[model samples]
Target: MSSEHFDVVVVGAGLSGIGAGYHLQTLCPDRSYVILEGRAQLGGTWDLFRYPGIRSDSDMYTLGYSFKPWTQAKAIADGPAILDYVTQTARENGIDRHIRYRQHVKSAAWSTDEARWTVQAEGPDGPVSYTCSFLFMCSGYYNYAAGHTPEFAGAADFGGRIVHPQHWPSDLDYAGKRVVVIGSGATAVTLVPELAKSAAHVTMLQRSPTYVVSRPSEDRFANWLRAKLPAKAAYGITRWKNVLFSMFFFNLARRKPEKVKERLLAMVRVHLGPDYDVGTHFTPRYNPWDQRLCLVPDADLFDALKSGAAEVVTDRIAHFTPGGILLEGGRELAADVVVTATGLELQLLSDVAFEVDGVPVDLASTYNYKGMMYSGVPNLAHSFGYTNASWTLKADLTCFYVCRLLNTLQKRGLRQTTPRIGAEALKPQPFLDFTSGYVTRAMEKFPKQGHRWPWKLYQNYAQDLVTLKYGSVDIEMEFSNPVPTHAQKRATADA
Candidate 1:
């Protein structure tokens, strides 16, 4: 079959991909594009995760796209509701038609002479190829096929069912059964309270403590604004309000770690009361924002604890016995079901091999350009969001910048644009500065960031809004008009 060609090709059909498509259509109408999704669905994370009580950690006002307003009453929406929003956005914007599901991009090769990417993918009918002027990777940062689960001793000896939240069984029954969730992150915080509703007792077994906070399920300010203002206006106002609040709190936590830690623990004490041993279970060794603080809507986790339906046990797992898990102190907790809400395995560029003129691209050796593009990579952009704020806050800005770059290229008649790192004495740092286990584990696999401007990845949205949205792309970027020679055509034909 002849290879299909387009002006642009998007790697995933998730939130970022759909937003990129919308921006491409609205900003650069002349350009043609298609979204290639590995899975046979539009919702990427929302569709893949089906564990109990899966919801967004970030508020929906900022998580929602700037172009579209999220009019839902609950800001912390469930998985199904968020999925509906994503699919609905795709349908309303006519982006769903451009999506080719189950097209897993295996590799992408960029030719300097042609100034285009030859993408190879595996589909149902077998191999397929496509050429595009630009490639946008929105595949997210984690492995879709698997999650991080540690090897526990005697895992096979357990008589009860054990499940990872990444691939939760749909048919498994847990009503009135003892459930133990093994984790302390956002996933575990969400699952414990939710599973306690039906389970006879639910226990959160964590090796260490994590910072948890509680917020209202519905945004009263946003609701009030919506009542008074127009839909778009209300959304914009609430979006900015949340953006500023997030930035302020993040800065405060960084500036005054001790004070912030005290305040956070104080809030926990208010929720769990003084009688409960908050020091043993709620106190973390690190300060606030070291890792992301888990959010429980309306103190639901605390409510569950108060009602005596759920409990937290901070101890190391010695082994899994036939009845349940045995802690290091010889204490055993009986459970009928064990849900491992561990962490995600970070995957950069969806693990798709990249080549530049037949030479394999070494991503680790390169530097991140403005947190969007990569050094020496031509006509390619990847969307990675802010660690401290809502993901879409950065995603929207990145998409806008990509659109701007594309428009400029079209106007200037440029075939390719690549970031060329200057010879400056700069120290290389990990891509993400967070102390989360997943980020720390995958540091070496990701590209390093520089200490200076443009080369540095700023987690601050305010700075990024100015740089990515309004900044010029000419600095540190090389624009060129590539023309294929007769020798190059001969070499291509021979190959």
Candidate 2:
């Protein structure tokens, strides 16, 4: 069988992939590319999640693409709205046509002799193959098929339905029924208020308190700017404004943890009133931004609690009883339904098997290069976002950097370029400095960062912007290994 070839092959047709397509179209229009998506739909996260009140934890101005303007009123938009935005982007830019749906990428092999990567995927019919000069992996950081669900003793004993938010049932009705939502992450916080709207009472059962902050769904400043200026102009200003503010707050949180923690708890008190036990249900042991802070739009979660529609329960589950979950201290929270909003299952390169010149490549053993490319990985890039800020911020920068690299390769007439590092040049560090359970559980499987520049992950968007956008690509990068014409011919014949 003959394999289709292109200048670039992008894995995953999610937010990152669509942005990459746009960048390639505008920046490198001469290059041909294709997007291979595992799922039937285009939007990855937005399309996959369909639980009640599903929305973005980050504001849309920053979560949205750098090239596109978020014209919606709500800065913290819902799932459908965000999906429409992503779909609209692809449709408008003609990126949708380039996407091959239901193509689950299985493996990729890089050939140094031919200066290309042969990608294999499990298509609907059977196995499919393609080759590309450059490979871009944008398939987010988590497993789409499953979430991190801990085993609960006697879970089978529960009479009512138990569902994980990752796979929420469509027809399962909970109207006027008691509901217990497990976990205090963004999903749990978002679900409680929305579930409380219909459920008789919603109980948020969390193992530990997570820092929660509330803001309006719509941004007044952003709205005012939109009214006064053009779409792109207003979006640019609002995006920067949010970026700078978040950086400042994150820096403050790190510098003065106690002060920031107290201030955050104080805000929770103002929302829950003086009688509420802020320390028990709201105060977190960790500093702010150590893990991501959960965001509630317009203090919805607090309002639900105050109105007696919902309540926060801080305890460990002893077991799942017939009526509901039984706590460790003999307290039983009776519920008709249970929703596990447990965290995600993290993965590297979407768990795709990679081989470099017939040798298996273990990503965890390699060092990260500017948080995009791995050390000694030739002509490949991965799009990973920030922990403290919006994901698209780093994604946008990564796309720009990849395009720049492709242009450089073409200009210099080079076939392959890899990040070259001396054996003792730098000390190894954790790729992400985050302490979240999802991150910690899968940290060992990820690539390591280094103590110095180009190998370090700053996580700060401003620093990344400077390095990826305007920084030199020649630093520690070996640009050689141009394939001979006859060598390419021989490789083609063998394939």
Candidate 3:
């Protein structure tokens, strides 16, 4: 049988993969590569998540690519807008031609003899294999098709609509109906506010509390600059400005809790008034940024609360009954709809089972290399974006590093490159130290950070910029492959 081959193969056609594809093309204009998208269409996360009020939680500049400046006036773009942006990038660079939609790569195996990966793929048509010298996994950590739902004691029998944000029903009708949004993190916070505008009354139920901060969707300073300066310059400045502001507040919230909390409460007091239960509802027990800060789009959520559209009920869910969910205080939330914006199922290296020569490689046992590469994986890099800065910052660096490695391989005639991270070096960091429900739920499966400083994700943009973008971390990569030879000729010569 003939073998399909390419210089490189990128999994996932989202921002990271597209960026990787673009970089690869730029590095080798004539080199051939293929981008395999599991989804029927491009735009992995953005396209997959179609929940209400979907938007980028982070600022645009850093979240967006540096090469292609985000020209949108409002830097915090909606999910659809972000999707459009990525798709446009794909189209502009003529990257769509290289993308094979509906192609899911099941497993990849490295051959020491061939110095390449034989990727087993499944598409709509049938099973096909591709031999690529390099493999880039950008499938992301979250399971796109579904979210994690805890086993509620009596949840199975409850007849009311039970929906996870990951698998939101497009035809869901919440108009004039009672709604309940479970979980305290970003998704629940975002979901409740939007659903409340039309629903009879939206109740946000949580096991614990979260810090909810409100800001205008469009910043006045940004608006003022947008009016005065060129869009590009304005966007760049706005991006940095927001980045600094976020860092200041986030770090302040982390380091100096009292001062930050005082200010946070003061702002909440001004919005909700002194009569409201600030301690019970507004204030979180945990340190700020310990969990993700809940972003209220344009302060609309508070506005919704002020207008009596939405309300908060901070209570532990006892169990679910057929008609409603029972709380700890013996109160029942007779919800017409229940949205479990609980969390995602994190699958490190996207649950891809790999083997070397016949030995099965365990993903759980493997340590992450610089939070991007796996210790045992050779010539492979995963797109784990910046949790602190704009996601694109890390992605850009990863792409840059991949390009560097590829260029070096071509020059040195190297076929495979794998890092050398030993067990002793991988003792320090875990994926995250947060008590957040989601991270806790998926802790056992995710990759832990190594003892090496930069190898662990510090979640700081400036730090990563220096390390991944500029640091010299490239190690040994052997360049050799086996070729068919005439054995009879060798024997005759030997004789």
How does residue 179 of candidate 3 score in lDDT? 89
Superposition TM-score, candidate 1 onto the true structure = 0.98
Q: Which model is ahead, 1 or 3, in terms of lDDT? A: 1
lDDT order, best first, reads: 2, 1, 3
Task: Name model 1 segments beyond 4 Å from true.
Answer: 488-495
Clashing residue pairs, backbone N/CA/C < 3 A, model 3: 217-298, 414-479
**Each model's TM-score?**
0.98, 0.98, 0.92
lDDT (Cα, tens digit) per residue for candidate 1, span 117-234 = 9999999999999999999999999999999998999889999999999999999899999999999999999999999999999999999999999999999999999999999999
Cα lDDT computed for each candidate against the true fold: 0.94, 0.94, 0.79
**Regions of model 2 farther than 4 Å from truth:** 484-495
Better of 2 and 3 by lDDT: 2
List, in order, the clash count of every candidate structure.
0, 0, 2
TM-score of 3: 0.92
Candidate 3 on 1-495: residue-level lDDT in tens?
355899889999988889988888987776689999888999888899999988887767778876777777666689999999999999999999999888888889887666778888887988878888888898887777678988777888687898998888989999998889988787887888789878999988887777887776666787788789987787778777877776777778778988877787788778887788878887888777777777776776677778888988889889998887999899999888899878888776667778765577776666677667766667788888865556787788788877877776777766767766643555746776677777788778876676566446677766766776677656322334344246744766799
Question: What is the Å distance of residue 195 in model 1 from its true position?
Answer: 0.4
Instruction: Give the per-residue lDDT digits (tens) of candidate 2, residues 470-490.
Output: 989999998886556786788
